[model samples]
Target chain A: MKAVQLKDIRKSYGQNPEVLKGINAAIEPGEFFVLVGPSGCGKSTMLRIIAGLEEVSEGELIIGSETANRLRPNERDLSMVFQNYALFPHLTVEQNIMFGLHVKKIAKSEQIKRCKEAAEMLGISDYLMRKPKELSGGQRQRVALARAIVTHAPICLMDEPLSNLDAKLRARMRSEIRQIQRKLGITMIYVTHDQTEAMTMADRMMILNHGEVQQVGKPLDIYNNPQNTFVASFIGSPPMNLTAAHVNKGKLQIANKWNIKVDGYQDGEVIIGVRPEAILPANEGLPAADVKVANVEVLGTETLVSFELEGNKQWIAKWPGQWSAEIGEILQVSVDHNKIELFDAVTGERLEKTHSKKVLEVVL
Target chain B: MSLPQAQQETQSFVKQRWLGNSRRFASLLEGLLYLLPSILLFTVFLFYPLMKTLYLSFFYSDAQGVPLSFAGFDHFVQLFSSSSFMTSMKATLLFVLYTVPPGIILALALALLANEKLRGIGFFRTIFSSTMGMSVAASSVIWMFMYNPAIGIANRFLTWAGLSEIQWLLDPGWALISVSIATIWMNTGFTFMILLGGLQNIDSQLYESAKIAGVSRFYSLRKITLPMLSPTLFFVITVSMINAFQTFGQIDILTKGGPMETTNVIVYAIYKDAFINYNVGSASAQAVLLFFGILIVTLIQFKLGERKVHYQ
Candidate 1:
């Protein structure tokens, strides 16, 4: 197995604008790296560039310690599974799995051996003689995976290979793919728009937006500590609650309502952020706020209680299940003082908690 | 019931009567009305002529195409046994063999070339597909001049290459071949346009997958491109085979069934018997045979080729 290094990788479309700015990341051998973003965020473009399907405008692509910018896709000895499966519609499942072997002119016996093994591994031995059109979407996906794995390439590039499946199948396949990756120990760079897939499957995930690298770190690390406003708003499922606030010497005023002793550092104007699960009911310890409940979503295991702090600023507390609250119920909710994140009001940049008073400017 | 409910009940009664039982008959009328124009055209131009041709095939007819007496099976028996009619069938088969397979291959080649991305590629595509817009007669006349035995551009090139000057349409051996060449040239553009459309409809990701699989471009073409394009190829082959048997204009202009009857295709044979020689009964019989020949050929193609065609 080999590692993948992308140094100052940038891509530009013709005359419109740059789609990917200089992105740098090193994927270790056997790492399941995920590149994620919203639509048109250049994640797919990056995948295509790595696959050698699209030319990169500028970068050094180092695969196994060699400059790979000039190598063809096949020459790079990597395999890719496409989002649509991209199976040969006319070929039988066995033939599809053994396509690379056939192309490489391997011995006929070797080809048959690999095909048989792959078919059995994928649990598609019964479908060996059937064409891709005859298989369901999940079966076709298995065939695609089997095809890639049979090649035994050290690097595997998957472009959202599980995106086309139904939800239940997708969740099941997600873990199956992870297990497979671990078994093979191949460096896989997967591109997806789903944060769940990225968070659940990646060894490390990179968040891209507007061609810029917003954050890149271990999934849980990035979730717990975001680099900026975008990462904070993007990572969690019902992301962190952020509201405008004015901070002065041990006092926090949010819309002139919920006052808190959030001391330490930044004075003047700031943005306060806290995760939904971090907020608790009034008597349940920590710093508290008197709020009017706006809505409540009771999702079996937990009820997400959303409320207004003042007139328009809505905040949410993810209360544990079966704890029902009525509409317009004025409940005292506590914002976890330790979990509070402060950011510069105008810059959308997280402020260091210790940058403090007598300091006219809070460093952005 | 209130006044409005009473009125609504009466309206519902009327609605049910108008829409429930009578709706079928009204929809039938509407469907027939929609089909009327197509039916009228098919009857006048296709159905009536097909029926008349079948009827006309069984009788001895006057020069004016009117039946004079019952010829029965005599015309068919005579036409089948005659050396001239049999020769016409052989020549027609040769013409098909010469023009069809190569036509498809050449058309597919041109389409593949045109499918590439390059500067001014559309210019080449327009030029390659130019013959689809060419009139059959205009192409025939142009090819005729090129096939001229002496001092034509074709012979000039042959001699310039140190090869002997050869008679084209004038030679008995080369007459059909010469006509087939012109027909192929005239047909390549249409077939190229069709195959190009087929190539465009193929998912581009298949090629990318092939590239990732480390397959050569040629391998991908044989395994993926051809099989994926089989539906379009089936259609092109069927149409070309039918068009080949029905070919008359190019042969008529270039050979006129001359050069010891080497280019006397069935259509030309039919033309000669009906108009030039005034033998309407035999001509009708020949035409009927040609119709069956086309039908059998097309059915055979579909039956054999469709197994490999992948629609998606």
Candidate 2:
């Protein structure tokens, strides 16, 4: 298996704006990469392009060291599991699994052997002779998986293969697919909108929005250090709470309160973002903001309380364990100063510490 | 038990039974009210004539639709034994062979051709299916002119191709074939429509997946398209079979059961017996036999198709 490299890939339909706007990435051999985005974000289209189902509008698609622009889908030697499973409904499970083998004209005995191994790996061995309609949604997904894997292709492209299953089944299949990918040592490019799947299954992920690449990095790295406000808000469940504030006279001015202090030379407006879990109950005399609780939802061991900032923009605080916070309650919540992320209000670009003025003293 | 309590229980049961009977009667009346029109139409147009034909087959009947005397299996026996009856049966089977399967195949081919994503494809589809709008008489007349041996365009083409023009609707051997061809052409449009609907119903994902698997187009067509289309094909086959056996208008207009009775299909024979010969018993017997023949052919097609139709 060789690495897949895409260079300045751009795809547009007719006169419309490009769906994938000059994307460049080099996926290493045997890497599990994910393309994640919201609906209509063209993540599936990217996967289809990689599978040779779509022609690139303009770019080089180097699969296994050869330009794949002119190759047919089957000639590209990549197998794809579609969002709808796309199993042949008329074919039995075994026949569906061995479809690629028959296409390549493999020997019958070997085809059966390989089909059995793939089905066994997917745990759908018992349904070999049954048609796809007889199987449940999850089983159909496994058949889709088996069909892809039985081809023994070096690269597997899965476009939301578990989207049709219930939440629990989706979670289970997520880990199973990852494990199988690692076991087979195949390069896999999975496309999904589910952040949990992106964070859990992906070794490296590229977050996309509005046909542009937002960020590409390891999951936790992207979670802890999102490059911009879009990544900050899109990578987490409750996402990071963002509010516009001004830096004036070496003090952070938020909603008429100038309490927090750090040495900075700028007196300019900025958007500050913090994760919901990074906000805590105010320390005895620390800088804090009074927030009116909007909604409180308790899920298992955690409580998510949404509150309005002084500007009336909503922000969520994820409190660990049970906490007594009623609706309309005014509470002082202290932000974790170290975990804060700041971006330019106009450009939405992250400001690096090297670019920031050195701190001399805390005015507080 | 207390005397008053037992009396109350028995009285309640009697009252409940009366109410239940009244509700049942009301519901029955309402059901019949809804079914009245269909029942009346079926009796008048379908069931009554079916039974009348069956009844008339066993009795001697004269012209003008009047029963004369009892005829014990004589008409049926005569129908089975007569050379002319045998000839008509042969003609019917030959017509079916000429039309039904080829009719289905040609229509399917047209449907497949029309079922493209190319621009203005709907125009071709409309042209292919426009014959469905034509009546039997209208199509027969048009085909009649086309089959004209001397001045028809068909003969014109034959002469232009440097071949002698053969008789289309007159010669004994060619008459059945010519009539069958015209009827098949008239009937292909509906079959094409049905098969096109079937083709549209099949999931396009199957074709895409086959393409991904490196299957050839013909293999995909055979393995995927044909299997998925079996149910619609079965319906078209059944309809064509029945229509082929019941062919009358085209034969009457084009062939007139002429040229030594070569194109004398069973329907034309029954028409002759009832109208020309005034033997209503023989006519009814032949009609009854035609019904059973169509029934058996349909059942056989269904029996073969049941194993193939993947409804989903």
Candidate 3:
């Protein structure tokens, strides 16, 4: 059921620098896998490598049991949707959708049938005769998707296909894309720099940084149990708050926050990661930390209160939408002992418990 | 006190109005200053001569250097009867038919080659367009040597390649065609530069989309590239056609209207009728007819181009 497998794929442009270094992953059939990274992380380059648009510098790209390292993009039997949509401006919607089939010399009747089905699925059936320029941005994107879908390729590669859309439309299209992938049951590898898009749309998302895989997991798993500080800081809105602290005699001390129990680490300084929502108004049986509320962002259903502890380290505290706080108010923030992540600050490695299964080792 | 304050306000308002009108006058004067030299030159050279040509085209000037009578369209009528004029008209039409297609084809070919993503493309592009720097007279002289009957490089190459010695510029049947071939070679680079610029402006993602849709490069070239490039093609055609009609420089230098006058195109015939024959009236009529021909060709090209240009 391996739809696509890239084994130790390493790519470098001449000798300037390594772009994608030693990437290895196997995408399951019908899986909607996403590659999420910042700019210059070479996520799009890896997708292009899979599409055979770029040659693999080393290692292998296996799509459906065939090695495609030396194959041309047209021969790879994969369809790609670019960030710009890349719709043929001269061709009508029907022609653009049927372009691949026409090239392969498929039967005209079959081509028509497939084109009609794709258009109907994307709700663009009436726009068959319209040129790409005449269509709206979202319609043009749907045409690009229809073009890829009509090819009936087992794998579809999307490189920030929704990046050009407005915020409202991008959110809508994110779900629409996931729905399309699931309905077709095709293996889709989507690339994006937007972590929200990755977190929402991916069946299993891979977080990459500096041309390396940071974490690959279900969205919630990475959120709750990031393997390292990088993933904790990378995966969430406003990111995680990492405080330089120490675990002495199994007690976590984060500058004035005291009597906190850490399970394993003994006597070394480590970075403590706590998500915005993890911190709360200190209650019974919890350690008290002196926190100064710096700023507050108001959402309709939730108000995010940003606070700073000792050493000027900031953390977010999410409360109910009705909650309000003064700008310079002093607050006591606390966290559940198990939700706290301890890491070696210098090495950036997780220092907490490690398990064989369900282990969250998100690294960047 | 109130009356004095109102007077003072009115005085300031009057000053503001005066300032506005003066600014307008200054702007008008500035515009007139910019256009003065060109306007004076046009009045002295172009408009004055055009008026004189208009007047003389209606007169009959006899060999005695006297205006014998005001003949209305008599010269035009006589030009229709003249066999050389008819031959020159036919040659001009034939020249247009010969040069237009080949010029367009050569330009398109060179543009496509220069559009390739390769190193040193700028150098190649400059070399292609540099032919525009060479005057038609210069190119014609060079090609005359190239078509020399005995020792010409073209003929010598053909002889060396084991082909028969084909009379190039000397044969009456091949004379006009030979001139057109040289004209196409010299001017195609101009069109090539224009079309190359057009091709570069086309969004490359369109081609990429076509390729991903499984469209072959040839089909994309035909369907997308050609339609997108039609505007540039139309421009080149219009310009090259005008160049074709005004093609006296080459014929004057190379053919001298020889080989049974097969190379006697319209403008060259105009030169002969005006300067050689000293019949400026008839030459002006021919010039007017050539102008109408060029105008018609250009209008038709634009009319056809409108339907093909994808404005996007």
Best lDDT among the predictions, by candidate number: 1
For each predicted model, how many residue pairs clash, with residues at least 3 apart or on different chains?
Answer: 0, 0, 2
Model 1 gets an lDDT of: 0.88
Give the per-residue lDDT digits (tens) of candidate 3, residues B181-223. Answer: 9988888778888989999988776776665566778888998
Residue A25, candidate 1: alpha-carbon lDDT: 89
Ranking by TM-score: 2, 1, 3
Better of 1 and 3 by DockQ: 1
Q: RMSD in Å for candidate 3, one decimal?
A: 5.4
lDDT of 2 by residue, A193-263 (tens): 99889999999999998878899999999999899988888899988988887777767656664245655
Note the residue pairs that clash in candidate 1.
none
In order of appearance, the predictions have TM-scores of 0.90, 0.92, 0.85
Model 1 ranges with Cα > 4 A deviation:
A14-16, A103-106, A244-252, A260-271, A286-294, A308-316, A326-332, A345-347, A355-364, B1-33, B148-151
User: In model 3, which runs have C-alpha deviations exceeding 4 angstroms?
Assistant: A243-263, A266-269, A282-287, A308-315, A354-364, B1-71, B118-123, B133-138
lDDT per residue, candidate 1, A274-311, as tens digits?
89988887775455556888999999999999998767
Please write out the lDDT profile of model 3 over residues A178-205, one tens digit for every residue.
Answer: 9999898989999999999999998898
- The top-ranked prediction according to TM-score is 2
TM-score per candidate for chain A alone: 0.93, 0.95, 0.93
